[model samples]
Target: FIRLMAKPEKLGDLREPRAYLTTIANGLVSDHWRRQSVEQTYLDALTLYPTEHQPSEEQRALPIELLLQLNTLLQQMKPLIRSTFLLSQLDGLTYRQIADQLHVSERTVKSYMAQAMLHCLRLKNQTDN
Candidate 1:
């Protein structure tokens, strides 16, 4: 239990150690399955491309990992910031367009985008370290 070792505080007030460990184990299993699903979806999409256009396995790993990291980051973000970031990055929407869609001002859209970018940079730095 690397997690338990790393965060020993989690065990501080445990009335049932078995239950606590089981919960952690269950969460790890769920996370494993979720990661597998994401990887599978990526691999499946790659199959639609011609063999000649396909990436090497080495190349594919990077995007899959990045996708997983991005997924985690988005999940941790505030809902409005997440929506704003997705609209601009994934949907190729302009700030004005996103602002209109979200019923916010253009300045507010810009602020949200800035916050999202800062969050991304912070995550990147953490991973790098």
Candidate 2:
């Protein structure tokens, strides 16, 4: 199990073999499930979208990849922050309108919008690498 669970170099330098192996295995398992959850959510969304509006084969892959990145970023955000961002961007609402709709102050809406933009820039940086 040690041989399978950890890299050879990790095993060679391990001060506590069992602890090291367990940590490595746990990380691997966590990453596996994270990727799986992202994939499942993307597939579920695609299914619910109107079939007539689906992208062509040549255009499909990039959007799907970008969508997964966007979804991951959005999932990490607060619910109100996500909603404020979407309403402002997708619905083309003004800050006052979002503040009114969300029953929050305009200052809070601006802060949420800033947080959302930072999240998007972080995702863009990740993709660039």
lDDT per residue as tens, model 2, 24-66? 8998897677767776776677778799876666666776677
Estimated TM-score for each candidate? 0.77, 0.59
Model 2 clash number: 0
- Model 1 spans > 4 angstroms off: 1-10, 15-19
57-119 in candidate 1: lDDT tens per residue? 899999999888877899789999999999999999999999999999999999999999999
| Candidate 2 TM-score to native | 0.59
Candidate 2 residue 26 Cα shift, in angstroms, is 13
Model 2 global lDDT (CA atoms, 0 to 1): 0.83
